[model samples]
Target chain A: MSWSFSIGSISGIRIRIHLTFALFFIWIGAAFWNEGGMAAMANGLAYILLLFLCVVLHEFGHILTARRFGSQTLDVVLLPIGGVARMKCIPEKPGQELAVALAGPGVNLVIAAVLFILLGSQTIMQDVAQPAKNVSLLSQLAVANIALAVFNLVPAFPMDGGRALRACLSYRMDRAAATKLATRIGHILAFGFGLFGFVSGYPLLMLVALFVFMGASAENNSTQLHQLARRLRVSDAMITQFSTLPVTSRIADAVALLIHSTQHDIPIVDGVGKPIGLLTRARLLRALHDLGADGQVADVMRTDVPTVSDRAELEDALRLMDEENFPAVMVADQRGHLIGMVTLENLDQMLLLARLQPRE
Target chain B: MSWSFSIGSISGIRIRIHLTFALFFIWIGAAFWNEGGMAAMANGLAYILLLFLCVVLHEFGHILTARRFGSQTLDVVLLPIGGVARMKCIPEKPGQELAVALAGPGVNLVIAAVLFILLGSQTIMQDVAQPAKNVSLLSQLAVANIALAVFNLVPAFPMDGGRALRACLSYRMDRAAATKLATRIGHILAFGFGLFGFVSGYPLLMLVALFVFMGASAENNSTQLHQLARRLRVSDAMITQFSTLPVTSRIADAVALLIHSTQHDIPIVDGVGKPIGLLTRARLLRALHDLGADGQVADVMRTDVPTVSDRAELEDALRLMDEENFPAVMVADQRGHLIGMVTLENLDQMLLLARLQPRE
Candidate 1:
């Protein structure tokens, strides 16, 4: 996502391309230029471009299916390996996920079938074993689409088949347990691929194996984190002993508090003991730079600081913090009095601890 | 980052490889085996592996420099195109960014120089023009490293040289302005590369041109967004008109409220008019699914719902919501009474409006 640039928006979704994907085009062009000159370069580029177009459509299948389940697709990025449709979040419901995963390969299957019908099945089959350079574009594309569908159907993590497998398994067990079992199977399959690649001296298969191995564990970890988040409460993670300031305090007071204590975000309370503002370290630093340390805390404190009740779900709390882009959230009691705070720094600590602690 | 798995941690930074990178090795292995057999395959693989090691070191150069500037390197992912060091954020200061950008190419220059010296200047120079297969490993690597350094130094968005150029430009102008100018120049350069690639029948260069062209505008858009965020406040964008429910209300009442009103988050207030909890549509739906409509709003409402001051910076509010991972943040007045709310849905609409509105 970092190195990606959007080429355009399609059907309300941004279509992005990673900088590296250019290398595939370049490499193929250079290879063809050296082998068969300008005409060959044109032919090769066109064929590959067509193939990439198919990849886009394949990704669109997944995107459309995901949209049906109410998931938003943020961007569709083309990498050298394949196109990745990044959704805001995947459907947690197994049936929805299963449909989304299958949709991609199904598109490819449809493309292959259509091409087969157009080009004649026997000719397409005969040309399937031939290299792209030696075969007709239609026949080559038909075979490539079939290969794409079959390759993606491999029961490996991060692949469509792996997700479908997990979805099916989830119907019979806990989501987390299903994920763990599916990931394990993915790893085993990856190991097989790696063994075969190494034995056959095919680095490509080994690379795929490595990808599968990594993807399986990564998905497992993410799902577990999500599960953990769902079970947590803001009260379980909020910091209760943090320092606070009255609205009448000067900026100098906040600077003094910073020196004497570890607190960076000091809540400002009203006469009624309600938190009226948050004096963040960044704001304090900027106020000091522009208005001097003698500036009133009231002038520097952010009045629109995000707050949460102690009983808020940790996931919801995290979601709020993420949405507001705030560094900390003040925790309030049922009386609407500030009781504690939740900061990203402390949330990370809580996550680390959660990882170490056993699941309930 | 979602699909990424850490192969290992080095110096507290995770090192990862994309699944497709293994394709490079596979390609080389197959190509070499077909050309010269096992010995050639071994030689080719070793050379390429060592080349990739140099790329890793190149990325480390950027990482170490960025770390010095207080930017955390989240992970280093190797793709077949090159290694990318994904930092939490680039340095805000121009000078620091310049140094970080140059550090990567500097590493490659050092590697090239060292290898050039080790292989002897004359021999290395002679072999530089030869194909990779015909040259000694050290000689080829020396040339390759030099090529890497030079290639990376070409001013292109998301590339090290382009960043350095922008950093230099930023010294004389606003960061957002500098980024826009730099991006425009990058697009021009990309156009040149594309034209040249087409003329020479080199699709690779065309691909690189496309990447550069897109990357420039993407970076420009992101920087502009950050700049816009710095200038706005939550009060400017929050939803002021929202319905509220008394804590004494039942879940059935909230359900009826939802059917008639567009508001999704129904804030629940206490007897004294202080906001106590939030009955989000999601929470209400889940409650209805499990507990039936007879549940009281007081029992179903999320007391930990995040709230924000009406006067906070929009960026800070966004950051808080993001960190808390909440969809919305309640806006409270100085009296600790909920007056408005900020939802991601509305925030996106505001962003779209901001994009269309001219800046001061």
Candidate 2:
């Protein structure tokens, strides 16, 4: 996010180029200049730009298909390796995942087919043997599209082919088991590809191998986390008991309360038991440290505490809590009365349990 | 962790190899086999294995230094890129961090020095210009050590030089400001290195560039989180109010309670207000679905719920909660009475707030 800047927007999704990608352009230009001259440099850069264009189209295939399946596309980032369309939706139902997975390569296949029709097989084959020579750009691009489709279909985890495999497997097994099987298969393929890449002295192929291996493991963890989220609700993970301060209470009382109770951000209520403000631990400490302890709780407590309904999904509640600024979100019942609170520390426990006691 | 397994341990720290790394060896071996037959294959494998040994020793430098500062190392992992010594203890105090940072490269410095002495500088100089020639192993190793030392001192984020820079800067300013400045420097260096790597055709340098750029952002985020943790206590992050189900409650009552309240993991209390067990939302739902709603709360509840003191640190409580399998941890007073509960959803709010409102 820091090194990348937005280049443009496509149907509401921002297209950003990472600094590495930009610098890569400069490097490619320099390399081409040394190889031939300005004309060659221009030619090489054009080829690369058009190639990345194809990559973008491939990414759109995944993006549009995922959107159709009801997942929101946040951003479209173009990198040296490929493009990424990040979304947090969990429509991993076997059928939906299979569709989304095949979409990217499906686009590449379509491009290859269109190019073959235009170029004719004999013309494209001429450049296929030695692409670096003064060959037609269209032919190279057509071959590259074919390569992209074939490469992506190699059943590597996190790749379209791997996802397709998992989806197919999920029809007969649980998602987790399906993922485990697909990931194992990915690992084996990664090993073979890496060996071939290393021996052949092609770093990009090795990079692909690394992606497959790492992607397999990362996807494995994510799948497990999603499985955990599927069964849990917000109330299941929110605390039911805590202490609060009163408007008439002093900073001294808040400090004492902090020292004695687990409630770091104490809700300040009036005589009728309505929260007038929230005194966060950081503010309380800063207040005590900066001034005397005699300040009224009403004068120091934060008044903008957000609230969520008790029956909200754990996933939704987490999203709300993450999007809001309050240290804790007040949990309220149907009557809109504050029944409890949720904090980051509380949810961290679930993460711990998820890691330690991984469900089969 | 999923793809990696322990190879061994050093001074209680487990040494693990990621699956990618293991597969990388296979790739290298195959590549060398095709390059120049069996002898060349053996030579290639030996060089790679020894090079990674240096990487491991370099990691040990950080692990040992960190331990000296009272930090614990959970594992020493051998990655394809390098090695990672994972530890959570924060001793980001300027002087201490500088020492830990330098200790790693310092190990390489010593290795190079000792190897130079053993191989003789004049003899090592012959292989320096072309390391792939039929040269003595000792001479090549000496040069490799020098390269290791120099590369690591590049002032890249998460690298020793970058951390040393932050430590030095921290002497004059707060850590957050120092990290921000150092991270910027790392970004610039990464760009320059990436450009050079791309033009000069060295993939390893490009990898280092990626490391610096990604490391800068990650370290920046981590530093901010630490700053947040440093100012807050457990009481600050804990939730303070909610409802609990009594042992006499039935599954029907739990269903009703779950529908009405935000508390998901309901504490089952006895007549004296002591928490005898905890009824997690998942279990309650599963019970109501499998059996009839007439099942008693006491008949189907987990009795292994853990407890924490009210005045504990947020960091410590989170760690404890993560280590235990309980859906929620009971917050108790000095007299050992269950005064409150901490759930996973509760702590999620703090993480959200931290990401939203970054403090300087």
The best candidate in terms of DockQ: 2
Q: CAPRI band of model 1?
A: incorrect
* Isolated chain A TM-score, each model: 0.76, 0.73
Off by over 4 Å in 2: A1-34, A45-131, A138-360, B1-75, B85-93, B130-133, B187-223, B241-308, B312-330, B339-360
TM-score winner: 2
lDDT of 2 at B333: 76
When candidate 1 is compared with the true two-chain complex, its DockQ is 0.02
lDDT (C-alpha) at residue B105 in model 1: 93
lDDT of 2 by residue, B66-139 (tens): 87888777887776778888776647678888988888888888988998888788877877766474787667
True contacts kept of 2: 0.03
Give the per-residue lDDT digits (tens) of candidate 1, residues A204-279: 5765788789979877876775677688787876776566888999877776565434356889998877899998
